[model samples]
Target chain A: MNRLFLSAIFALSFFFMQPAAMAADIEINTPAISAIKNSMQARHNQLAPHYTSGAVGLTRDGLIAVRDAKAVPLKDRQSVNTLVAAENKDRNALYKEIAVANQNPQWESDIRNTFAQRWVEKAKAGWWYQTASGWVQK
Target chain B: MKQHLPATLLALSLASILSACVTINIYFPAAAAEKAADRLIDEVWQVKERTDTPEPAATESETK
Candidate 1:
């Protein structure tokens, strides 16, 4: 009887501890995250020139945008818009993937904010990024 | 009454353990999250020079 009681308690504790143990890891990655990162990296080359030209800027919400539509040539503007849209979609997926990978979908906003700060921090000089006041060059 | 004691004790302990689980508020691990973000950003941007400066330790903010 005593053995059975101890076994029951141990099993219950293990079951309850699983989520806490899983939640401790915020850097967990899945195949989905890797695929999203690869897609974004491949598109970065296409977006780099626009970032330098002040046409595309990093938003405060962890997204890219066409800050100056006129900076892009009229013919290329549509393509730039498409690129921005694609980048944003990938970025959104990246954040959600990270959160879901960690088994905490509710943490998506926190993950996004962390990435937003990181993007601005890593941005090169003369690159445009957003701040609370407005868009500024980094 | 004597035979019921073991079952009662088991139920009480189980209730406390289950309640503990319900109240467990896992906070956002900000430092770990920041590190993960940096890793992904570096890859996406293909950054070579990583002169990283640690930011202020983020408070244990509840994300739930």
Candidate 2:
């Protein structure tokens, strides 16, 4: 009788609680970052010939400053530059890997350059970025 | 099997937790919507008397 009662309670709890717990509550929106991400994608497409992928990795401060504009301190600009350099290196490596993965046969440099130009055009005013002209505003 | 009861319950609990990724989508006016508004305002912003063409049907591409 006790075992039966326990089983009934357990079954009720599982059934009653399951649906509420399974509901989704995810929201995906960050306008400022989105603006930057769009700029980056445009940059990637423009630079497609130079690299198979144009994803320059972000540094610690670079990542934080992307969304929270107020977070960038004056002293962190050097860190941001370092981040840009690191990100560029990663992007270079990533492109090579992507090309290898996709087996793209030609015009890698041209595509990558186009992507870089697009990146330059779309960058937000204050984001740290590196260009052939050297590090400058996004 | 005595220990298995607890293990089975734990597995079920874990599965429930894993499966419960709740995503809520709240749609606000997107960029396209803002652009459309801008275009509409621009077209109508000029005051050239009251003899203008009637509003045309919105394009599918514009909404998207």
Candidate 3:
């Protein structure tokens, strides 16, 4: 009788734990998310040089910004501007896509904030990133 | 008395489980979302598997 009671309690606890675990895990492997990730990955190569040269930096708002316009040659400035614009556009779209994939478009801002923190956290040494105070080299 | 014990325990467990579900659903889950974002960012940046080597010089074509 005691064994049966213990087993029943264990099962009930497991049942209750399942939903909590699911609620805590954020899903990022949906088809829409995968496509966005691929696009971002492709763009990273283009952006890598600028990041290394300190011409561009990751912004606090989950976007990239051209930190020092003069870092690029005068002739290449326009191209750098174009690249930054395209990257920001794609990033905004990606956040929106992830929220939509989760069936909660209202979560877009939350998703963006999450990405903002993650980007800074994952930044390489010598890369510039914006913080609450100002730009800092990571 | 013995028959009522199982029913009472079941009822209490069900009530607790429902409350837990409600609580879990309400929060924004900021930590989990950040973790997921970091995972994807790491993959894009190739952070872990990168070799320490100088990048190629900018070719004339790339600048143009």
Candidate 4:
């Protein structure tokens, strides 16, 4: 009777643990994803100073505004255009890196939502961010 | 150079192993949306540039 009871308990525990074990795979890809995100964020941070400085006259918004606001006559339109193009590339790569962090699609959505909120919070004065009520003030 | 051939090969192998792993998707180009951001920034800049007081008392005196 004791042996039968032990057998039943073992089977019950195994059944209960299976779902948890499978669920953990969703997390298995997450560490890899996090690593990618860190690297991409680092890349953006690395470029941000040059973008912020008048190197090619790229504003936070992008090139044209920086051209009008900061650049001297010596800095040609082509320079601003080139910087804008590079910034676009890096920004696009940033999102791709974040998305690839995990195999699970849900993790991608979660990461997107998280960054969307962070972008809003970090926006400077007069920096218009999206809102539920349309493009109202930041 | 002859003495370090094994070290270079080992370094290349390790680099390949590391390079095989990384996941990240690029984002949509933010430049497309930058125009809107600039419009807003311009508005804010204009507000800051015009540092005037309300001048309510002056208006009241003129009214009197």
Best by DockQ: 3
State each candidate's clash count.
0, 23, 0, 11
**Model 2 CAPRI quality:** incorrect
- Cα lDDT tens digits, model 2, A1-138, are 546655765676566455444222111123432343344443433332212112332222212113232344566545544554544554444333322322331323423443344344433344345644544544
lDDT of model 4 at position A42: 44
Q: All models: lDDT? A: 0.85, 0.37, 0.83, 0.40
Model 3, A23-110: lDDT tens digits are 6888889887787788878888888989988999999899999999888999999989998998898889888987776656888999
TM-scores of all candidate predictions against the true structure: 0.72, 0.26, 0.79, 0.32
Rank order by TM-score, top first?
Answer: 3, 1, 4, 2
| lDDT over C-alpha atoms for residue A22 of model 1 | 60
- Judged by TM-score relative to the true structure, which candidate is superior, 3 or 4? 3
Cα lDDT tens digits for candidate 4, A97-124: 4444333343444444444554454444
Ranking by lDDT: 1, 3, 4, 2
- Candidate 2: tens digits of C-alpha lDDT, residues B1-64: 6856865676577556434422111222233223322332232222133244343466466655
Selected candidate, larger lDDT, 1 vs 2: 1
Report the CAPRI category for model 4.
incorrect
Candidate 1's residue-wise lDDT over B1-64, tens digit each? 8976887788788878766664453678787788888888888888964454333388568788
**Chain B TM-score for all candidates, comma-separated:** 0.41, 0.33, 0.60, 0.33
TM-score, cand. 3? 0.79
Worst 10 residues of 1 chain B by lDDT: B48-57
Best by TM-score: 3
| All candidates: DockQ | 0.28, 0.03, 0.46, 0.01
Instruction: Output the better candidate (1/3) by DockQ.
Output: 3
Q: Is candidate 2 or candidate 3 better by lDDT?
A: 3
- On a 0 to 1 DockQ scale, where is model 1? 0.28
Cα lDDT for residue A50, candidate 3: 90
- What digit string (tens of lDDT, one per residue) describes model 4 on residues B1-64? 7956765665565445333321112232233223323333333233354454242454355555
